[model samples]
Target: MQNQESEQVVRHPFGKFTYLLCSILTLLVGTAFMGSSRVSVMLFCLLFSTVLLTAVVSVCHRHKTLGIGLTLVVLMLILNVSSFLTRSYSLTVLHNSLVIIFLAFVFYHILSAVFHDDRVTLDTIIGTVSLYLLAGLLWSYLYSTILLVDPAAFRYDLVNAASEAVTLRNSDLQPLIYLSFVTMATLGYGDIVPVSGPAQTACYLQAVFGQFYFAILVSRLVAMYISAATHKNQQHAQGS
Candidate 1:
């Protein structure tokens, strides 16, 4: 009975949701780079929103405070759909605001899972990967917001016969998403550069965060694994 309880305690709730998130994020990144049509982008947005809401509800169902917050986020996401369809600039701001809020909630949940006291499980690893992907998504929305306000924030090189340099704008988010991950991973391709001061600052901050997160996560996980193993060995010795 005690062993069963221990196993149950270690079971994380977001494992399946984490897999779904990863798959959707991969598709979104691919679509972004392929120059997908506006309709396709909208479809992806719809799918993403739905999956995000479901994941939040699944992870936060038991916590009263998080559940209430999830309800508000759902309402905001619903409004975002209409605003997205109509292309209302004011509503777009509201939509972006809601997205940032939702991402924050999800980040909190992922951190909870990562720092869980019990033995590290498969779900913990999945949650960690989800957190990394979420970081990219968060930065993508931020860059998108910055570009919306300032059209000349980022400079893009023209790869083809076009002589003029392309400035980043809010029309398509694929490049921004790609740029976010590239910057987060410290892969400076030089194809897309943040020319504005604010943009440069944001990229530098993200790079530092990426390095810090990985270093801390690795050390924490290794420590937890060793502790769990030592405890188990001691238990076996006592039982014998």
Candidate 2:
């Protein structure tokens, strides 16, 4: 009856948690690439592959938290493409679109879980959807950082033009990239200043976006984790 018992039981003490952690690490690494580039471009591909593999496992097990895990991987891939393409607004729009997609999938997933019989629990549904939503917003900041680096179209130029009136003279790509991260993080030390109204505006927006996204999304993620833990505990007690 060992096989029978195993087939009848499902355990998620930390399975979902581990998957979410992997996704978060992947996103952080992607963000790190914004200011630095020691990691090869191919390595990015590999990192994303790991993220996707985790997502698939989560999904296959019918984990409540798969949505967010999957969304993060997808967003990372999109951002990677945006960076390599050198196209204006490609990353920005792609980021926004991904966020919207995350929200949509979450809504549908949660609704499905609630309506379907025994396929997914309410706790799992809410936890997965919430985490995915938060990750999307956080990843958007990465997109903004990318924009700061290239300032491909009017959106980026506007930010660079207004900061401190100092025109960028550095031809070295690394310095320019570092400047973008600083602008994105709002760590303006006055070492690099925006030269025009548009540039200043871009800087202001990036700072606002970063702070706002973190304040809201991070709180949501914490709440989801707590919910997941509560659910796991309930299941454990019942099993015992």
Q: What's the TM-score of every candidate structure? A: 0.82, 0.38
Candidate with maximal TM-score: 1
Q: Give one digit per residue, the lDDT tens place, for model 1 in 38-126.
A: 67776666666665765565457567856766776777777767776787776776677667777777778778867874777777777
In lDDT terms, how accurate is model 2? 0.50
- Each candidate: what lDDT? 0.75, 0.50
Q: Show pairs that collide, candidate 1.
A: none
- Please give me the total number of clashing residue pairs in predicted model 2: 18
Candidate 2's displacement at residue 30, Å, is: 6.9
- Candidate 1, residue 21: the lDDT equals 64
lDDT of 2 by residue, 1-240 (tens): 997667655443454435644564664456455422435545545654564555445443455566555656567576756655674455645644554464344445433433343333444544454444334433343344444554542222223445643333321233444455565566876665555555567567767755774576445556666787888899999999
Model 2: weakest 10-residue lDDT segment is: 165-174
